[model samples]
Target: MKINKILNNNAVVVKEDDQEKIVMGAGIAFQKSKNDVISQSKIEKIFVMSEGNKKFQELLKTLPEDVIELAEEIISYAEGFLKVPLSNHIHISLTDHISFAIERLKQGFRIQNKLITEIKTLYAQEFSIGLWAIDLIEKRTGVAIPEDEAAHIALHIHTAKLGASTMENTMKHTTMINEMIGVLEEESGSTVDPEGISHQRMVTHLHFALNRIETGEPFHDMDPDMLELIQTKYEGAFVLSQKMAQFIKDEYEVSFPASEVGYIALHIQRVLERT
Candidate 1:
């Protein structure tokens, strides 16, 4: 591909397939001019923009090279762990976040994430990867990142999976799930196993439930007979589910529907059986 614009000594913008792509490598653009053919052997990473080239180009211009490289490495590791291809925008979002995080640390300003516990509980795999990312950052830059940053990193990864532009909704869902799980553990007197199938089911159920609640979508109608039977058969779990419903009502001011209570009770029953 021919160089369309030079970004730095190690980075350049190239036109490929009538589209602009930001390419980076060591000394890849040194002494290179516009319309010059870039050497394939020297290219280390290429970022194709889905939104536009302006913001990404600006990010590359201001973001430190080491931070960008760390973001790429973290995304690569996350993709391998998740066994799925992540959106290319993660390269931009994650790099910008890490760069700014480092700057904030240098300025002695640390922001605490209220959703850290929720992020760790709900997105265990991604959160574990986030911790690994923290270690990688500390080793490379000698700047130790707090656990709160891991939650932020995991939120970025979760947003990438949905191809979303912001982390607001994701953080809300995570926080709600965490609070629900906290209620479950409190009532059951045991910690819920995040890696268990039961826990996964509960998380999936709550995820969709929260989505419905957020969008004001009504729950599917259920048979009153079955709901009564579930409540009677799993009385303990039903009571816990009631507590969960009340928690949601108090926290979000959205009343949890009765039709969904039985389903939540069933999940709680399964979790209780497992624990």
Candidate 2:
């Protein structure tokens, strides 16, 4: 197997029978190491490393910025799909994961589950992958995503293969709900004492957000005009929530873990922020 391209110090691209493949992170070959046979056991995953420099062995140490970026992209996708850290083997890196996830998303969306039960059963894995993808995106991107937004991604991943038209209202309300939670405070008496009403409202907004995201026309097409509408609704929700968060903060002045604040922030962002 002749060295075609070097991906990184521990990875390279090689050819078998003139076929191009991406070989992920792997062993390095130093200068004057040409024609040295790579161990069959050493070859890990395949990559389309078209841009590797000549003297691939010596070039192995320094990876091009784009290649590194590509590797990271693939790893994220793979981690999301496999729900685990990928093996060091280049063969199992993120590129393969991204390919697999996109394929699944395209296939799963084909069959629409208009009925709730069918959705729960037939599309469960797709939904799970969607959830996985969202969580990965959130943790990686540091963008607080609400449960509803997370659910939207899950549902879309479940139904992305389908040809059904997405609804616009979903994005609008989801944004609104997030905005609603973002500004919640312990003061100004915006929060309901019972807690039930607030919870119910939050849930309701979440549902709307999910529905819109899954089927919304505006968001699906990336309409710029919708930004203002989304922002306006989000502000309304934010005002309501700001007061509520303050209320809770004051009422529970006892130190609460930052996780609680994060959770609430995520909920709000989910409702208010667009992926």
Candidate 3:
């Protein structure tokens, strides 16, 4: 194999026997350049992305090299820790997720994952891998990832552990989240700045709320006094939550807990304030 392009010190684009491949290993591309002969023993992994998976190719091009390296390392840990081979789709999905997450953090944005407890309870091994991922990321990037983000990573690992059925459900949940966000925007009489942290927080809230409801996990009880305060003070936000709750019942045929509804109102109030 010969290096066609260096993605980073640990990664390279190469060609072997007329096939283009992404090869990675520690320091494999160190001081190396295009057309350099690659030592076969140094190649740890070869990503032979199918031509049909154009998104994977695009991710390869668009992802920052460190994020690529970090995601691969995390994936490797997840597989080993879980003792299972994951869907190749994770190579694209998780890498893209990490890239965005890192950029979001750099921009001083934090997305809270309300699903953390359920995730820890249900997917312990994957959660462990998520913890490991955050530690490694902090060491490399000097950014401390919140525990909630670890749970988020665990969900990604768990999803990638299965087949199309699980992926389909995940996609369905994502679509529903987008619709719920649209409803909130309409109710608040404001368009969410898609790139803003407030938007991320709202989306995260809705996404986890859906997961929490469907999984039958217990939601935290909102304080009665504080809840009444918000209901009275942020009346519009409370209305927004009520409309969203009704939408959930009408569309998904499920009802969010009253506590969850209160949290939704708080999230709505925050977004409205930021907007």
List the candidates ranked by lDDT, beginning with the highest: 1, 3, 2
Please state every model's RMSD to the true fold in angstroms.
4.0, 16.5, 10.4
Candidate 1's residue-wise lDDT over 1-275, tens digit each?
A: 89999877778988888877888888898888999999999988888855644676887788777887788789989988998888777777888899999989978998688767556666778899999999999999999799999988998897888554257778767778888889889988999876778888888888888888878888997799999998899999999999998998999886778979889999999999998
1-275 in candidate 2: lDDT tens per residue? 66665555556556777766555433443331434556667655454434342333233344343334444554456456746554333322233333334344445532222222222333355446545654664555454433333344444443223342232433333334344333342222244321344344445544443444345423223234443444455555444444544553465332223323333333554434321
Candidate 3 residue pairs that clash: none
What does candidate 2 score in Cα RMSD to the true structure? 16.5
Clashes of 2: 56
Across residues 150-252, which tens digit of lDDT does each residue of candidate 3 receive?
9779878988886523755665666666667778878767987665666667677777777878788888888899889989998898988889888978997
Clashes of each: 0, 56, 0
Candidate with maximal lDDT: 1
Cα misplacement distance, residue 84 of candidate 2 (Å): 8.5
Candidate 1 off by > 4 Å: 16-18, 31-35, 48-51, 162-166, 181-204, 211-240, 247-255, 265-275
What is the lDDT of every predicted structure here?
Answer: 0.84, 0.42, 0.79
Q: How many backbone clashes does candidate 3 have?
A: 0
